[model samples]
Target: MSEYRAGKAGINAEAQARINSKYNDEIAQETLEWIQKITGSPANTAGDAENLYEVLKDGTLLCHLVNKFQEGSVKKINQSTMAFKCMENINAFLEAVKKLGVPSQETFQTIDLWEKQNLYSVVVCLQSLGRKAGNFGLPSMGPKESERNVREFSEDQLKAGQNVISLQYGSNKGQQSGISFGNRRQI
Candidate 1:
């Protein structure tokens, strides 16, 4: 007798299609071109999600790309085809990019690329890295990252802000609902 097994819980088809719809072929193509220019080699794949995944799933190119931004950022790039080895390379690339000023939130998890679960997220991470590349004096692919804008206030300004009540605390003007709470209805 065969034992019964349950299907894995994961994203539904509609949700997956929604995510896939958000993936822009143009952006992916540009990102691939940028990677090729930086790495000095062709990616040898079309910019679609499936092709991009096949090209980058191993993570070798990602490690190479990060190293171009910062010399020796990823100390060891795995060359094996083993699952864990590829994941290690992806993780290493993520860590190296994080050190190079790419925010952790902007980076993709290994499984996202490894399993092809969310290729759009991978493209987003690459685009973020490309934007961060501007800090290294390299040509950026997408929109440039915004610089930090910090403001300081004097002691008087701080005190004035504390004393003033902002209009955001909207005035109720004693308005009340006609209905009463915790009261029984008379038949």
Candidate 2:
């Protein structure tokens, strides 16, 4: 999900040229400004914005955002299941782009940059709000807030196979007579 850089000479020079020409440094600059506004963060007039935007335009931004958002937002290990759900959405986005047609380097790179700068921050905010105590442990990397799992199970199914032990071992409270009758032999 890293940024995109123009590779060797074999790439369709016309296409690359078109992307470079159409996007230009100005587009990167403007997109960076937009990212700052969206995220409510300081502007990156520094080269960081341009560099990130290039990657966004390449079609790798979804993956990068998913991974980072997953890492920065998840507070516990069990949250991984939730993180995976978020990753699925990112995958869907990538699939949609593929179905449409490959994006121009400029377009993809710009989008990637926006995710890294703005969308990512939003994920972080969401993660903070969603955090809760968990029986599972935390990861070494960090919390992630990509997406939540929409998968659900029926309440009846969840209750099945559970060992509901009563605390009153010796007490007759709520005891059924069937077991007592079975214990007594018939005359």
Candidate 3:
């Protein structure tokens, strides 16, 4: 905790930040690996707080705290799935911002500056947390989060026989025709 006058980073806080940097990464990475094994889900900061708030509009500088599932004060990833972890992360981040006592309802708040200044420290610690063991990708969205395949086709696609529906009878010419509801007029 030296009193070096690091720019922007205050003197006292800078020392503590460096000291924290020493061990936080080692522990965080270990936890991340453990989380990956039990749940088979990677510690991904892929949504909401990490995505919207932590990240820059140009998709740069994602904040570390945004990854609540992995890096939150509360443990999120485990054998049990947290369906509400996204909201939890968002609330956690916003609550932290509010606690900062910055009264504003716009983009680029004090929190952004707070996060940016401390981002490297947090990121080093988090990245030091390292990745989970296996090359696991995102977890399955489960039945609720899974998307249903649409069985619709335009007139052209239908006749294209992407999915051919054969209707053959005993004595009929081998022919295929798409069902169409053509406009008909009667006199």
* Candidate maximizing lDDT: 1
- The true-structure Cα RMSD of candidate 1 reads 4.6
Per-residue CA lDDT of model 1 for 114-139, tens digit only, reads 87767888998999999988788788
Give one digit per residue, the lDDT tens place, for model 2 in 1-187: 2347544365665654544443334434443443343334333433343464343333233433322323432222221334345444444434443333323231222232333433332222222322311111322121443456697889887687365655654777766666664497455
RMSD after CA superposition, every candidate? 4.6, 20.6, 20.9
TM-score of 3: 0.23
Instruction: Please provide the root mean square deviation of candidate 3 (C-alpha atoms, Å).
Output: 20.9
What residue runs in model 2 are displaced by over 4 Å at the alpha carbon?
Answer: 1-6, 46-50, 54-187
lDDT of each: 0.83, 0.37, 0.36
Q: Which candidate has the highest TM-score of all?
A: 1
Worst 10 residues of 1 by lDDT: 1-10
Tens digit per residue, CA lDDT, model 3, 1-187: 1135354457857775675454443434444444344444444534322332233222112222334233443333222123244334433444443333322342232323234433333333223222321222323121222246889779998778756655552444554445347845443
lDDT (0-100) at residue 49 of candidate 2?
37
All candidates in order of TM-score, best leading? 1, 2, 3
